[model samples]
Target: MTKPGAVSSAQLSRRSLLRRSALFGGAALLGPAVLSACGDDDAGATAAAASGTKVSTVFSWVKNVEWAGFWVGDDQGYYTDEGIAPDWIGGGPNAPENVQVLEAGKAGIGLASDTLKIIDAAAQGADFVMFAATLQESPVGFAWLDPNIKSIHDLVGKTLGGDSSSPSMIDACFKVNGIANDYNFIQIGADPAPLANGQVDAILCYTTNQVSVLEAQGLTVFSATLTEFGVPLYADALIAKRSFLDANHEAVVRFLRATIKGHEKNIQDPELGARLATEKYGVDLALDYDGQLTENRKQIELWVSDVTRKKGVLWMDKDYIAGPVYEGIRAAGRTELPDVNKLVDLSFLTEAYDGKTTLLSA
Candidate 1:
């Protein structure tokens, strides 16, 4: 979500509203010839750029605590250690879509949040390739003030509020439970104040964002995540043009190596990570320090999994993609699926970890 100002009732509501209206629309692909977007011998030039291999990475949102790991990696000189130089481009409500930037050669790599939209682009023949997913589980959830609504099924007959994606999530949840759409869903523009004030039964929100804000206001918020409802979708995917990866495979691996180190640093000390964002990288954003710290702690919860614990952070599981990820997308509305093989390539992360779960090697 895009932040407006410091954490306050007005800021929180504004931020959530901006996030809801942020719908993804497809951008035209420029094709393999678009490699010119990086200039001649793109790979060679990137490797030889003044300080180190210059790699411009585009993100789906602003330079806030959401990307603390990357900021930490840059600040810690992790990229330099790997003979790489990173140029971070921030995206937000007014920015072009991540894929559009990649297509236009404005960025070599991108971090995107919409898995279904990525598949749609690939299905339409974009050269995008997802190398890793930062968030292994979807954080989309329904928060309610009622203690009686313990699970998803408990809200079958209740009124729900959410943004554009909320309906798909609800439909997917109901599809899995073999139940009909029995609830009244109004697009409340991602505001949970209605739920808190008893105007709506539930409102869809991210536990890391809106829920945290409500709870910080001393409201007892009970929620269930999409994964908990049997629909797991990936978020914050790291992607790049297939042509770029084909030419600079080694650079991609090194980039992941440094990035994983950054995440490890954040996981070990979240307070320091929060400071890195609010105090340095995102200083101009006027981000709330305590809010960012709380978000950092909550965001960490979505980055790890049993798969990641064994394979390392940002691990790509083919089985998981083919199963839950694909199923969740299908339930959401996309029936035609892109081949998972073309959509994801795990070679970069595989080489980055080198048969080890932890990159530092103790």
Candidate 2:
């Protein structure tokens, strides 16, 4: 019953950035509170800060606060502290992973949502695996508030938003509800203001993101979690090649160490990261990023509810990672399914959180 749609292709050009400093708005609530950990050496325990090892990583997108840890790690010199020099890579439209980059040993790890990338690479003579996931609540659901549209049954003829950014998780949820193909989606940009502004009845959205942004802006959204209604799909995983993991286990562990520190910082001082990210990811976000630091903080906190909050817990679920993922993607008619295991690897996170420090406690 799961069904997905083809994402229209686009180019990967860095767009012109519009800057809005929350501190400029004059509202204390909008301004990011100065946090104590900005440059604090909290990572002394986990990161060895060794030098001479070189690495490369490509980000899925730029300016999304989700990857703030990478920036903070680079800015805070966490990677340097670990003694590894990382050549942070960039991504844009049609990035297509360029598996050869990691395959030919040009890069050490690749970041993706699921093991699909890794699995596909394996199938194609490459190697990869997903480990830790950044976004907890996948946020793959419909964004609508029309009283007449309480459930999927009401979506038969309504105009749903669409775009390559549309999530396959929504398809899984809709299939579980036995409502696939019930409505039509109109493809648009990543920004879902059209749905919020009443341009359409609803928009497929990520709970951890777009809908949350809209709701915080005084717009209420009626949402359905991908797992809540039906299929289970993991989102935004920290992935690396299997061979790479076997070879760079220590470096991978350090990468997770730096990343865990960043996420914990995001959880503890969300405003600081969000504000810095607003200015950091200049082209991606539409709203004032600094103004939305509180929003980002709230969104990230809600992302890791009770279950995933336990110390040393990385939320590793193979069924969630491999199952409905390909089901929905194939159903949605995506060209091919990437290798599930290739898209994921947990050793990094396992080693990262296995330390004496707890992300929840930190």
Model-by-model lDDT, in order?
0.70, 0.51
Worst 10 residues of 2 by lDDT: 28-37
TM-score of candidate 1 versus the correct structure, residues matched by position: 0.81
Q: Positional deviation of 246 in candidate 1, in angstroms?
A: 1.7
Model 2 per-residue lDDT tens digits across residues 89-136: 544333434344455554566555433334444556655566676655
Candidate 1 per-residue lDDT, tens place, 250-271, comes to 8888888998998888888888
In lDDT terms, how accurate is model 2?
0.51
Best model number under TM-score: 1
* RMSD, one per candidate, in order: 6.6, 9.5
